[model samples]
Target chain A: MQFGIFSVSDITRDPVSGETPSEAERIDAIVQIAEKAEEVGLDVFAIGEHHNPPFFSSSPTTLLSHIAAKTKKLTVSTATTLITTNDPVRIAEEYAMLQHLAKGRMDLMLGRGNTAPVYPWFGADIRQSLPLALENYNLLHRLWREDVVDWEGKFRTPLQGFTSTPRPLDDLPPFVWHGSIRTPEIAEQAAYYGDGFFANNIFWPKEHYMRLIKFYRQRYAHYGHGTEKQAIVGLGGQAYIAKRSQDALNEFRPYFNEAPVYGHGPRMEDFMEQTPLSVGSPQEVIDKTLTFREHFGDYQRQMFLMDHAGLPLKTVLNQLDLLGEEVVPVLRKEIEARQDPETAKPPTHAKRLKDKYGDGPARQPKPNANRGDNVTGGSPYQDSE
Target chain B: MGQNFQLVVVSAGTSDPSSTRLLADRVAGRVTTLAGKKAQTVGTSVVELRELASEIANALVSNHIGPKLQKAIATLQRADAIVASTPVYKAGASGLFTSFFQILDNDLLIAKPVVLAATAGTARHALVVDDQMRGLFAYLRTVVVPTSLFASTEDWQDNGLNKRIDRAALELVALMTSGFEKSVRDESWGSYQHEYGSAGGTELSIDLDSDLMKLAAGGSAGQKSAG
Candidate 1:
């Protein structure tokens, strides 16, 4: 399993400290946190993309590329890159560019953004968001795999002979994960494409995602990708830990009471019991997280949301330390021992590269020099006709 | 058909034996007696919404369904008929009552029989049951009886309240015994608005032929919108 931490990039006020960090301060803190994650031996660091106030991450590629530059082994990715509002053409070009920059230390998860008003801001309709997401992702899929693409879709203008530049770092697109809270169509999309389906298992009850995941696995097999066991799956979780369970509860109580997503609604104990949220010692968190594989079957990735809800940077770093030191290693072993052998390996660029080409040279797209335009070319590169 | 017809009473009254529950109990009692006259037995269960107050609040806010709330939902799911009564507060039905209904799955009560009842301190909020609660049950696609029972402080000792309760109970018995909910489930369930895991978690089948599923399969969305 790939153990990682994902941040929603909320600039929240620390309830105890009574201070909200500035955007710049939060940005700096995220970088330090990512570096600390690598130092502590976590496998991945992902950030969420939000365009509205109190959220700092609008451009995920820029931030991820910087993190990728800073850390060697720790994979940098997005909790979700918006598929609804963002133009698929831009997503294709920019993420492929990030793939090349990071030397394939990056991948992305796609979500129809939760904010509704963001649709109108980008000249899209919220009512048609589902179809928009489906259509846009269809176009994005083609843009990544096909070099010379002739595409027309409902959401964007027609493209004749368009080539997304940088060509995806060794002729392989980054592995994609479709993250959804309650949309089965998104799961079907992921299954149809043989991509990963990530359930943001933080806010809602497990039953909510259980049905969707089961449907995804069935559809994946129906689509001839593999058996249900081989389909890639990931889950999102939240945790706050201390040596003693009481301290963990006492310290997180104030933040839990006022969280932006689900605070002021349910007691911390109730939320933890119903949802996948685990708050307590390392053993407690581990026990709760292990139940995920049993509920959804063997999965590839497990990501925790630890930095949001106005948590201080120092606290986030310390939590990462406990996670890296006391939690993830044990989880890695436990999951590996318990997982079915047919379970697909957690996705990475090198593994994908090896899968694409074995003991053979990967594609290097050196363009045929300076064709006047893409319109009159048989192929963009010398490798194809 | 296998056993006594299941009737559930959902009371959102604050007190243990508040007037709202009293009104619901009276209706349920009459329904039991009426069913017995037809040579059929009735099994009744109570779900006092006050007991699920925090669970309702939690479900409303965080989408977290507690253990007690899940058991209540299971009861309502298996109910052949329901008597839903609420206490009126500030010219509206109690928040506890409305909040509980708001969190239920849209298709959970489809075609089920229900008798709507309300209790208040005055006659001014009498319309709250018919005007407000009826709209909610209608939106859920339930078959609510015609006679809405509203018992204020003065109506308790009056003979007129008993007449309405009897009339409402008869309507409920007719709807329930007619096999309406079963026919809807067996024949026309697909016509209603539902999704996977709806209807108290019994609706788990996905329609793969849907327009959205076609879109998910790389089919363009234009044909769907255009049609």
Candidate 2:
């Protein structure tokens, strides 16, 4: 399994220190964290997008591109890109551009954003989130494959002879993983398209995601993509590591009691027992993560939420060191040994490009220079002339 | 076809010998006797929220039911009929009673026959059964019998309480004998939405031919209009 860390990019007061990092400081710290992940031999660095206050990652492509430019080996991705609010046309172009810049060291997980008010701000309706996500992703899927697209949908204005520019790097569209907490329709959508389904396995009980992942896998096989075992899956997790289990618990308790999303709710001990939030030594974290395969079956990717809840940058870095040096290496070996040969590996840029075109040149669409009205439809360019 | 009926009693009483549990047991006994008169066998189970207080509270915060709560929820789901009794506190139903239902899957009780009963300290809060509990079960879409039983301190000594209980039991048995639960579970279960991790709850399946799915697949307005 590919192991990495995903951050929601929240700026909160350190519950212990009572000092909150400025937005600039948090943004800069994320870059440093991503670089450290690579240095410690982690495989991926994904970030969440939020448009409201306390969350700074409104622009993921910019952040990911900067990280990609700085690192060569570590894959940069989004924990979730808002497929509901963002125009599919823009997603097609921006991600395609990022693919070229990062040399295909990127992929994205699509989700309907959690914040409701963001819908009205983006000129969309919250009630239509699932439909918007489906339609937008359908359009986005077509944009990357088809050179000229004639499309009409309920949410956006109709498109005729539209070509999303900066066609995907090497003409291979980035692999997409649909992330969902509760919606089964999203799972169906992912299975219908033969894409990956990622369950944010933190926060809720394992039974909740087990059903979703099982449904996705069964549907994936039903859709004739592959056998159930070959369907790609990803899971989210959270951990805090120290030399001793007590030290891990004692240090994380304060942060856990005051963190957003789960603070003031379940006690830290109960939450750990109930959910996938692991607070303990490196061995303890490993033992907990290994159980994921038993719970959801053999999966392709595993991402941990280590940097949120106002944990300091240094502490997060220290946690990452333990993860990379002590945890992931063992997990990689143990998981690979148990993985069935029939199971699919996580998708990457090179593999996708080769799958699309074996020993042949990839597509490079040469647009016919500006033909004012694409509707009139005469080879909008000089080449056709 | 006649089959054994599953009756689940949910009592939200805190005291050792709570009037709420007494009311629930009485209603359950009457229902079993009434159904037996109709030559139908009824199997009964009880979920005492007083015993599951901590588990319910933990479930409320953790969003996942413990083993005991899960068993209780499962028992309720398997029930052909339910007798739900709660004590009225301060002109409202007990918080524990409300919280238990809140944690339950809204669709779990859909179309299942329920006999709503509540016990209160005075006759003034007698309307709690209909006013509050009825509304709550209505939101759950349960087929609550019209004759709700309310037991006050004086109700125990009055003959009207037995009459009301018998009337409610008769309605519940009639609904149960009609096999409403079987029809819902077998024939039209797909029509209902189910919460994730709910007992016997399946994934939300979509009708591919529906307008919403068509629109999601990028079908145009004209095509929708044509259909």
Candidate 3:
């Protein structure tokens, strides 16, 4: 099981001060949140990309690449890579490069994105989104595995001969998860390719995510990915935890009520009861999150939307300390103890690359001794030829 | 026998008969042999500082790279495969190479199969390929081949280097010919229109007499629309 935090990059008003963070303050806060995620023994921290107002991350790679140098052991990924809008080639190369820089600790969650204007800005129509997502991802998948690609499609121009470089480290590309909120089409896309399906279960109820997960598992098996249980799965969660349930609710309530995504929509208590959002003690969050496996089946990665809602940097950091110290260790132990090796396999970078390549371990290298001495032979000139 | 693939080698070494270019040629030769009659090769040597100096000294400031450069760029843009070889300088790719990279058409290398090769003085410099070079390519949105063939003088003297190159060539051929063929069903159906989509006209049409008022007032008129 992987434990991580994700942010939507919203600049929120400080609950205590009633003052909103400047864009610069919000950007710096995102960096601090990511650093804290690492300090707390978390395995990953993902940042969402949104180009519109109130959101800061226009370039996720620039942010992730910076994070790659700042921390070790924490895999950085995009909450969404906007498969429908960005060119598949750029995505393939950028992440492949990050995989090398991060030493294989990179993965991406592809989505059609939440904003509609982004489509037209990228010269794509919203109506062709599903087809664009499907076609673009198909091209991206090949780009990572194949050395040369000759692709001709409705969305992008044909390639007579094309090769993306520099190569991936260890001959393996990063793993990918197709993220979906309500669209069965995205789930079907993930299933068709036998890739991981991330059901962002935070917005919907368990029953809704269950159907989506079930559909993916069945179709995953249909595509011969693996047995239903073996299909790679990850879930999304939103939480705000404290040592006591009452304190947690009191602190998070005002923030939640004002949150642009869910604020003013449902009462905090009703929202918590209906969705995967846990606003209470650490134990309560852990327990509520653990029961999720029963509804969606054994999952590979568990991510929480903690840094959203304009929580101050200090509070978010404190929440991470509790989640990592009190929550993740327990989840890891429980998930591991319950896992059946015969049916359950933790997702690994190598496994995903093999799945994508449609082959066994990348071709092995052979040595040649005929060109010996010249290998070490110098410039053959010492200022006198 | 029916498969046709194009090989583009991007070399960034300054010296004529440079080791990096030699290594690039060897890789290209192996591909040519592997693809038999169906393979063609396009090679570009981007001695960056020199190109930049010339561009800076002349009216060529338009970032409008020439036909020869465009032909080399097309190798990356339109080729089925690429073998990019460069000499390591200060523990990273040459500045010349990076500057040329800055001018490449956006997203031209996406999904294209690429083999990375580098020639450095010592194995200690291997990090140059893994860290800096690979890092730069990722920003450009290209899929780098996973298995790289790195050559150091010591390995060459011990006769261990060429063997790796051979293996790289063979494996690269298999990956490109099989996987790329399957991924791309048609070779010439104009899929690249989106990538090479009109980059606005590069033609320099400077009409000083046309309308100075419209040019100067254009700024104010735009603000008025916003008002």
Candidate 4:
């Protein structure tokens, strides 16, 4: 299983310190945090994209590229890139460019973006978001593979023989994960394309994810992707660990009690008891996380939400130490021992390229110096003709 | 679908022996007797909101439905009829009562027969049941009886309160006997709005042939004129 941490990139006031870090500091801190994630032996470091205030990651590829450049072994990805508002052409271009820059050490998750105003501001409709997501993803799926694409969709202007440049690193599309908490249609989309389905199982109970994950797996097999066991799955979790359980709870209480998403909503203990949140010692966290597999079955990836809700950089780094040092190792060993061999591993750049080309060289599309015409085969490129 | 029907009472009264519970029980009792007279059996179950106040609040704020709240939801989902009574506070239904209903899935109570009752200290808030609470049940799409039961201290001593209880009970029994909920649920359920996993997580039906489903499978959206 792949272990990682994902952040919503909210820059909030520290409840205990009574001070909010500036965007610059938070930006710098996220880079440091991503570096620490790699240092602490974690595999992936993903960040959310938000076009609103108190959120700094409006440009996920830029931030992720910087992090990818700074780290060697870690995979950088998006918690969710807006599939509704963002033009698929731009997503295809920008993320492919990021793929090339990062040496194929990246993937992306697509979401409809629940924030309502973001739709109209980006010339899209919230009412049309689900269909928009489906249509955009369809175009996006073609863009990465079909070099010369003639495409027309409702949300965007039609394209005639348009090729998204910076052809995917090793000519393989960065693996896509359809992230959804509730929508079964998104799960079906993920299954239909044999893409990964990531359940943001943070706020809601496990039963909600269990239902959707089952559907995704069933549909995955129905679509001839793989067996139900082979369908890729990912789950989101929250953890605050210390050497002692009480200290972990006490330290995390203020942050939990003041968080924008959950503060004043439910007591931290109740949330931990009912949801996937584990605020305790490493052993306690490990025990609680183990139940996830029992409920959702053996899945591919587990991403803990570690860096948001106004946690100081130092505390976050320290939390990573416990996670990387104490928590993840035990989880890895135990989960591996119990996992079904038929379950697919989470997608990575190297594995995907290998899957495409067994032992041979991967595709390297060489363009024909912007000939500005698709007359020479579908693609106006050296490789196509 | 059976001769024996389940009647679930959801009482948001806080006291040891609350008048809200008393009012709902009066309605339930009459419904049981009335059903018996019609050669049917009614089993009553109570969901004391006083016991689930924290759970409902937690669910509202945190979206985590507690075990007790889950059980209550399951009980209500199985209910053929419901007697939902609340104590009026500050000229409105109690927050516990409102929050509990607000947290329930919109489709859970669709077409279910219900009797609305309220016990307030003053008769000034008699409109709390008809004026405020009825709108809530309407939103849930529940078939609430036309008679709204309001029990003030004075009304408890008056025979008029018993008359209202009998009317609401008789209305609920008639709706249940007619099997209106069964027909709407069986025949026209899809016409009602529902989230994918709403209705206490039992609404698991997925239409793979839906227009959205086709779009999810790489079909065009705006080009084809979306539903």
Tell me the spans in candidate 2 whose CA falls farther than 4 Å from its real position: A364-385, B1-3, B58-62, B193-227
Q: What's each prediction's TM-score?
A: 0.97, 0.92, 0.58, 0.97
- The alpha-carbon lDDT assigned to residue A276 of candidate 2 equals 92
Using lDDT, rank the candidates from best to worst.
4, 1, 2, 3
Docking class for candidate 3: incorrect
- State which candidate has the highest lDDT: 4
For model 4 chain B, where is the 10-residue window of minimal lDDT?
B218-227
Question: lDDT tens digits, residues B81-147, model 1?
Answer: 9999999999998999999999999999999999999999999998998889999999999999999
lDDT of 1 at A134: 95
**Model 4 residue B81 lDDT score:** 96
What lDDT score belongs to each candidate, Candidate 1 first? 0.91, 0.87, 0.70, 0.92
True contacts kept of each: 0.55, 0.25, 0.00, 0.71
Query: After best superposition, candidate 1 residue A229: deviation in angstroms?
Result: 1.0
Off by over 4 Å in 4: A372-378, B222-227
lDDT of 4 at A279: 96
What are the per-model DockQ values? 0.55, 0.33, 0.01, 0.65
DockQ score, prediction 1? 0.55
Q: List, residue by residue over B1-227, the lDDT tens digit for candidate 3.
A: 26556667777767777888778788878777766644533333332234343332211333333334545554455566777887777777776667666666545565566667788888888767777777767765556766676777776575567776777777667667665533542553234333112111111122222232122111111211221
TM-score of chain B of each: 0.94, 0.87, 0.68, 0.96
Candidate 3 lDDT at B219 equals 13
Question: Alpha-carbon error at A127 in model 2, in Å?
Answer: 1.2
